[model samples]
Target: MRITELIDRTTLFDRILLVFLLFVTGASIVLIPLYLPHGGQIRIEVNNKLLYKLPINEDKTIPIGGLTVEIKAGKVRVADSDCPGKICVKQGWIDSGAIICLPNRVVITVEGTAAAPKGVDATT
Candidate 1:
């Protein structure tokens, strides 16, 4: 009827296994983020064409059409844009994923060595 009663009914071996599993889960939560790969480069595309491939380590501001992209401290963001909604500019700095300015036909993506393998569903 109660959690304590259920736990008390568990054998010593079961308790040990539960503790081990908890430890493993905690370790995974802490360690997984550390091992995950970080973006190494920023790719800028215009009109579905590759426009620039810049290193994430270097800080720079790029101007394309009416949009201004700023990269700083290994992060990239759309600092300014002429788009009506300003959604891209509001998205702020990002270390991973992409920023799209639909009106300007611009897309910015962060890429790294751990990119999805060829022939695999990257979205997954």
Candidate 2:
């Protein structure tokens, strides 16, 4: 019937287990950024202008527009942002693909290795 009544039906162990799970999930969400691996070369752009091209091996921080991009130990991520949602910061580390902050017009992408195609060998 009532919401409280339904909760009351649950045993104390069940409630404790639910609370434990919630705590674990929330903690994991907050700590995930610390464990993500960094990727290749990084290209950062802000407000439609090419800003910085950095090697992934270096550890540095760059302030671009309203966001702070952090590169460390061969990984890259938006460490801080002035935008409303901080969506870019939540993107964590990216080895490939792009992390875009629409509100601040900041874009970060991991550049892949470029290898020229070899000429075709003799074919019978």
Candidate 3:
């Protein structure tokens, strides 16, 4: 039978309770992410080793090996690198995701307050 038929068979209080529960579930799904704090720092790594967990709020330039990462106004970009492709530099500034240079083995990731996965040295 249809879900509406089942609801119709229930008493008024039961129907109201079910509706309230559904509303709560839906609200939580929509609001939880909005309330979660955005990541305030950039996690930099090279060859799977933690390099830096610098705050994105302050503009800075970091030189990790042959790669130069520039952080400005809460965003980061691969300003320069010795890698041949230069794909990492072309990716542009980003507030999230990652800017990875395979040749130089440099990785920059933006994360929220959530902790990085276990065994991963990238997040500090």
**Candidate 1, RMSD to the unseen true structure:** 9.8
Question: What C-alpha lDDT does candidate 2 achieve relative to the native structure?
Answer: 0.81
User: Residues 23-110, candidate 3, lDDT per residue (tens digit)?
Assistant: 9999987886566445577889889998798888889987888888999988899988898999999999888678889999888888
Better-scoring candidate (TM-score), 2 or 3? 3
Candidate 2 ranges beyond 4 A from true positions: 1-38, 114-124
Q: Best candidate, TM-score-wise?
A: 1
In order of appearance, the predictions have TM-scores of: 0.62, 0.59, 0.61
- lDDT tens readout by residue for model 1, 1-124: 9999988899999989989999999998888656644668888999999999999889999999999999999999999999999999999998877899999999998888545577857596
TM-score of 2: 0.59
User: In model 1, which runs have C-alpha deviations exceeding 4 angstroms?
Assistant: 1-37, 114-124
Query: lDDT value for candidate 3?
Result: 0.84
Each prediction's Cα lDDT score? 0.90, 0.81, 0.84
In terms of lDDT, model 1 sits at 0.90
